[model samples]
Target: MEVGVWWTRFRAVLAFSDAVVVLGAAACVPLLGGARDPWPVLLAAAAAWWVALGVGGSRDQRYLGVGQEEYKRLVSVTVHLIGVVALVALLLRTDAPRPYLTTAAPVGAAALLLTRWGWRQWLHARRRHDPTWSHRVLLVGNGATVDHLSRQLASRAHLGYHVVCTWEVTSAHEVDIAETARALVRLARRNEADVIAVTTSDALSSELLRRLGWLLEGTGLQLVVVPGLLAVAGPRVHTRPIAGLHLLCIEEPTFTGATRVAKRVFDVAAAGAALVALSPALLAIALAVRTTSPGPVFYSQTRIGKHGRPFRMVKFRTMSTDADHRRAELLTANELDGPMFKMRDDPRVTPVGRWLRRYSLDELPQLFNVLLGRMSLVGPRPPLPDEVRRYAKDTRRRLLVTPGLTGLWQISGRSNLSWSDGVALDLQYVENWSFTTDLVILWKTARVVVAGTGAY
Candidate 1:
């Protein structure tokens, strides 16, 4: 199962799914008592929608497996299709069925998106166990750049990239661009690679990159140029071609703005609603903890928040009353790397406490922290004061925003993550924070909690 062949099949499936959605929407129009000859109208609408999707690049392979670009293109195409329908009706001056058009557009778009999401889930699941679904990549660049890019890609296996081999250029000046391109082609062919990824290097000039692209032309292998910049989100990075050079302009991350305000508003509304809606469950958890453990129902610990401020983060007590006193005794048995302490089977944890921690029910009390503006619904995990004290200068940037009840680290692996990995994820979130990213994290958090992985 070569990646190229698999991708072609995947694309065909997507096309079929889109066609089915269009047909279903058309079928709905006749059922809704639209025009006498609904077939013509339905066909016209379907054709227009398909054309719109093509024009908007909704089916672009580059955006298929990763990022929100695919979703954005779908939304854009759907909107354009609706507008086209309205304009045509206005110009033709005919009795158009407004209800049918409105209903079909939304329904079709939703179905298409849902279908794509389902496929993505299936693909990701397959990738978890088998690398066959992933593109075999031939990496070429300077040593440092290649290693960095390889690690980044390897960490995100869900993106479907497997680095098969790497060619390290000690000095780009020593090799000619034409020769390098030939070498790359040979390596790709030898490794049966589906993609050739060249990381940005100081030695390689833009002209050389262009030459490589020209060499890869009509070769069936995709050539991807990885920019040197790290931790930059797509929205912040804009490509501008000026003077025959592709310049990537990166924007600084926003800390305060209308977007930030919207995030705050969402956090407040969601946290408040959850507190009210889950009050019964919260009460039950409190009672369970109180009856099962010889400790207070709630545990409040000093955690570092935004700008190094300290706040009392509350959680349902998940350990015995003497847990803190016994911390020194278990220090030698700490299972987690870095400053945080974790043990899969700690003697201090009561049976009920273990269950609460597993599903993150213990952290439900943090809705109060979010409501009080001491935390957010999505951000970096709140670090204990002792953990914060061990932070390096670069890690301190995570404090620029409020801590979160759930975040990249939480949804990623929770206690299973190494300290450095957790910090890397947190820093990535801090540097590329967006409302969309928050929504994705929150959605993933639900799944992670349900699975109860990496929870201690």
Candidate 2:
């Protein structure tokens, strides 16, 4: 039941799962009609991939159930393995069997990813039911920072950090570094905590942090120092060691150039393809909206986009024909805070509109907006002019990129998210934009839309 035991068992199961998947995929190459004498190349590639994953830090205890780093490393290892296989084939002048090189490798890689995801899901379930299965974390810092960090960790149980103890030292007076370090180690040992999460403060200076690390040198306890700067993504952060000092460097957020062009191209192509593929469903939704309500099939409202530009955002009409005119009467009944308006059971929403909104079928028309260069497949939610006007200076950063049909807001909680929380998620996405992030968001959007949580 201890955290270390659970982690060891989890990692062992994950390795076993990876090996089975790799061998299964390799075995299928021959069964699925591959080249003769394929066993040597196929088996070698499988063994290499399995070993790479085990040694590549993909299964590191720190990255098991949290963040995208594990998945990213998995992808990187797969790519490297494939490149090595191809180079070997070219140098030896022996054409690798197409099935072994292409089909088996890709299948094995996909299966490995799925296997890791499955193990994460299992680990999360176990942690949820038995918090002891999670990483026992001891929080160390000033009171305010510790409280803030504790609240964050408590809210995200799936991250597997369970706060077991807190050591709040006041910054008003200098503290004894050695004494504090010894006390921290004692507290961690007494509480059986696997991690010591420290928030930076004057009282817990760099010297104290260094001492704490030294005390925990061979204790097998992780020392996690949370920098004062919050909401910065990993991809935007880099570490530079200079003159015996480790410096944290934050890269400027990307907004234009090749990244923009790549994003734009992806948006247009995906939107165009989605429009064609879902034409029939779109027609059905359009017909339902038109027949069930006395309003037009599509509703276009002026929304604020990138750089504060106003554009007509279109969606399947999910309210009455006079929805805007009747909005004044329902202003006081709005369920959401801030400038946005939302109601769980608004009287103006038609029966069909309610259904459309639940599954987000109403937002399908925005694919056209995406194709028109006014919107993106993934970015901050497009705000209304009133909302934009109410935005504080920092909040205005959401306009740096084209608005999205679905973004962090859509997956996090949609209408269920508070105004401050919504702003924070948007800002995090804006500051940490990556193509991989977009893909992950898009993939999660499908599940959120199906579950219909946080939607009115």
Candidate 3:
């Protein structure tokens, strides 16, 4: 089904669900110490809520998925509606029951938000199995940019964009703007495209884009302009209209503030609690490692941390005692790219070590690092000193914050990632660090660990 039709149906379903919640809350009023004759006020409040939702664009197609903006708008609209209701009650001198109003507003809002979240999860699940659920995207730009954007969209399937066709132009100046716009319209119709995404090109002028937007009017085709900036999140990017020009402003990454302090506090509390809670498991792993290998139960390695500081990162020993001594001989057989050394099946790993590595039980000891302020619960993976020495100027930015026990790299493929891909994920995390993003990464990490994929 087309995304537009699916969205329309989804919006209708949401409206019906919201109305049910409002009525359900109204029904609870008398049971929760309120007047039985609450139907009139409850119906009026429901009508006001419906109008507020529409005015706030809570059901807008653009803000439907994967972000907190839709929920924020929903809460905002509900609060405003409640305020208006209270104002009207006051103005009319109607003795509104406080218990009913308080209970109904919160309960109804919670129900509406929960239903929206459930629907979003359903949509995401459908998108994974059915390509038809995605918005059909028509890409237009130079070959390089088109390929780049296509790969990005392909990597994040949950974003609901499926590139149906790509129109590659050597230079936008090669074609007339009006002719190009006409060609796009024809192509979009032919491909049943819901969106036309154009990547940044020097040949395309603002005036040309303006004319193209005009031509696309009434065609129901949404035009999206992709900026050249890579690895930047929405919170750091803003559009400013200066005079007649729409300038895209990029904000610098913030490494200090109350948020950072809160992150540290959370890391300490979570790490400390986890250590205490999992102490029995930790002891069992230690005993197993000690009995299975000649080496010590715990291994500590010097890893580079925030601002070029070095710290001892502890982990369960997963290799024979002579593993480090044998490193030089195995360097030639390294399977990984860049400065890192990795092999799917290394002879140095003991029998128990292999199992520990496979499930990442080896890294559990890093909670101490997090507790001691040497690392965070979530951030870029700590790099070896040798890895840091070989880093490019841009890759060094990952050191701006504390290293992590597990990070984007860990959840996103772990040992399976190539050096470039690993570095990119780390840099992306560093540049777009947020508490919400951390929570998302941690949730995904739990799932990934359970699946035991890409771990050596």
Of the candidates shown, which would achieve the greatest lDDT relative to the real structure? 2
Superposition error at 218 for model 2 (Å): 1.5
Per-residue lDDT tens digits of candidate 2, residues 154-194? 87777799999999988636688888899889999999999
Better of 1 and 2 by lDDT: 2
Q: List the residue pairs that clash in candidate 1.
A: none
Which clashing pairs does model 3 show?
none
Candidates ranked by lDDT, best first? 2, 3, 1
> On residues 1-456, what C-alpha lDDT tens digit does candidate 1 reach at each position?
865876777777778788788878777766776655557767876776776776788777787787788888998888776777688878999656575566787888888899889988887787767778889999988887888888888878889999999988887668787887888889899999989988877777777778878988898889888876777878899989999776889999999999999999999999999999999999899889888767689999899999999999999998888888999899889887788888888999999989999999999999999999999999998888888888889999999999999889999888998888888889999998999999999999999999999899
lDDT of 3 by residue, 1-456 (tens): 764786787778777877787778777777787766746866775676776787898888888866888899989987877777788778898866465558877887898898888888888888777768788999988888899889888878877898999988786559688888888878988999989988878877676678879988998889998888878999999989999777889999989999999999999999999999999999999999988768799999999999999999999999988888898899998988888899888999999999988888999999988988999999988889998999999999989999997899999889988999999999999999999999989888898888889998
Candidate 2: stretches off by over 4 Å:
35-48, 82-99, 172-174
lDDT of 1: 0.86
How large is the C-alpha RMSD of every model relative to the true structure? Answer: 1.8, 2.2, 2.5
TM-scores vs. true structure, each candidate: 0.95, 0.93, 0.91
> How big is the RMSD of model 2?
2.2
Q: Measured by TM-score, how close is model 1 to the native structure?
A: 0.95
- State how far residue 353 of model 1 sits from its true place (Å): 0.5
